[model samples]
Target: MSNVKNTVIVITGASSGIGAASAIKLASLGGKVVLAARNEEKLKALVAEIRNAGGEASYFVTNVTDKTSLVGLVEFAIKQYGRIDSLVNNAGLMLFSDWKDVVVDDWEKMIDTNIKGYLYAIAAALPQMLEQGHGKILNMSSVAGLHVGGSSGVYSATKFFIRGITESLRKEVGVDSGVQVSMISPGVIDTGWADKVSDAKGREAAKALNEIAITPEQVADAVAYALDQPTNLTINDIVIHPTKQDW
Candidate 1:
């Protein structure tokens, strides 16, 4: 039996990278994927692509950093599919910078999108899932959470926070409720994020680091594997880094 068949799954950051890849993959597996992101154009195109492939999908313009947008996203999914089976929290920011550079603005951006954005989405979705009696939550993190480098202090800290949140959610909610909680951590994915880095030095470093990075689809595969499981079994966490990437 397909664990994702006919299930309604909501994915944040569905406009690009791992989120978009996971949305396509899950939809192909008979999942009704609701794409949520700030980029309406990309989300619409992705939804159209999924539908053209004979997969069920829809788009909802959402700014994960905004609580109201998250609430609306969850509402949109429930309105379209009646219930949410899973949530893929994949939106995040990684503006790497050294401590001496004191890029406080970058730090705040990461905290807002990576940390609070996740919490806001959970706040919007958890209640609905709890009432429905069964659901799954998959948070996207980074290997940086496991080992922080010199320039990724704030970005890594946000992922570490995600790790902590996933554990707490599993223990507090998944222990008894039908809800399941899981996290997928990937390292140095080639998602064009290297060019998006704001700090000049950090951007160059990120580009070099991405030379040994894996593709977003690879991380999406890990996400699928974690979600495609029996209800009685929860794949708690998955760590996926390129074989060439050492430490």
Candidate 2:
């Protein structure tokens, strides 16, 4: 495993869940964490908490859906820390509904936030990482990406796209540019993600699944573990789930 001390790691969707937990864990491991999320209040509070814990940290209010906003996030990290060692593209959406329900708006929202947002994060961070000759991009996928489930077809599609893109990106950048790309696919994690489900049936199913879900901190630990790997050894993909989760 590589040392994270003084490494500048940027995390998006950092207000809660895996992003927030990863920020705290990485900071504790001596990373200079830069938190980004749309919620300014939460970002400030998290930054303060990191600082109080004797870890270097900062934040930028960002909307990952906007390409320019992600650019600004990268800029903030560079301005504060002088280098971008890794970017955790954890901002995503998971609005689920049966295709028969035709939640077109929800589908568009998922496309914009989950797929496009993931692309924008890569677009914004890749240039600097390439120029530096060594960096990591850890993206958040899901077990849904591996297999389609009931009522989550569109959401699963987005994650599947992420999975393909992360794999392609790893091949494109890892050997030549010294940048490593990784994808974390978590199953039934307990987070605010399910709260975004608008369909009644989807929400009910999510509730039942979350009853046996793993905590966000567990996912965060996986993030830290991936980042801790030696530079030459890329942890390409990780699929984690609660032991009791059959799916």
Which lDDT values do the candidates have, in the order given?
0.93, 0.91
Query: For residues 1-247, what per-residue lDDT tens digits would candidate 2 score against the true structure?
Result: 2478889999999998899999999999999999999999999999999999999999999998999999999998899878899999898888778989999999999899899999998999999999999999999999999989999999999999999999899989997889989989999988966777899999888787889989999999999999988888999889999999887
lDDT of 1 at 87: 96
Q: Provide TM-scores for the models.
A: 0.99, 0.98
What's the CA error at residue 170 for candidate 2, in Å?
Answer: 0.8
Candidate 2 has what TM-score? 0.98
What is the RMSD, in Å, between candidate 2 and the native fold over all Cα? 1.0
Kindly report which residue stretches of model 2 are placed more than 4 angstroms away from their true locations once superposed: none
Which tens-of-lDDT digit does each residue in 102-129 have in candidate 1?
9999999899999999999999999999
Q: Ten residues in a row with the worst lDDT in model 2? A: 1-10
Supply every candidate's count of residue pairs whose N, Cα or C atoms clash at under 3 angstroms: 0, 0
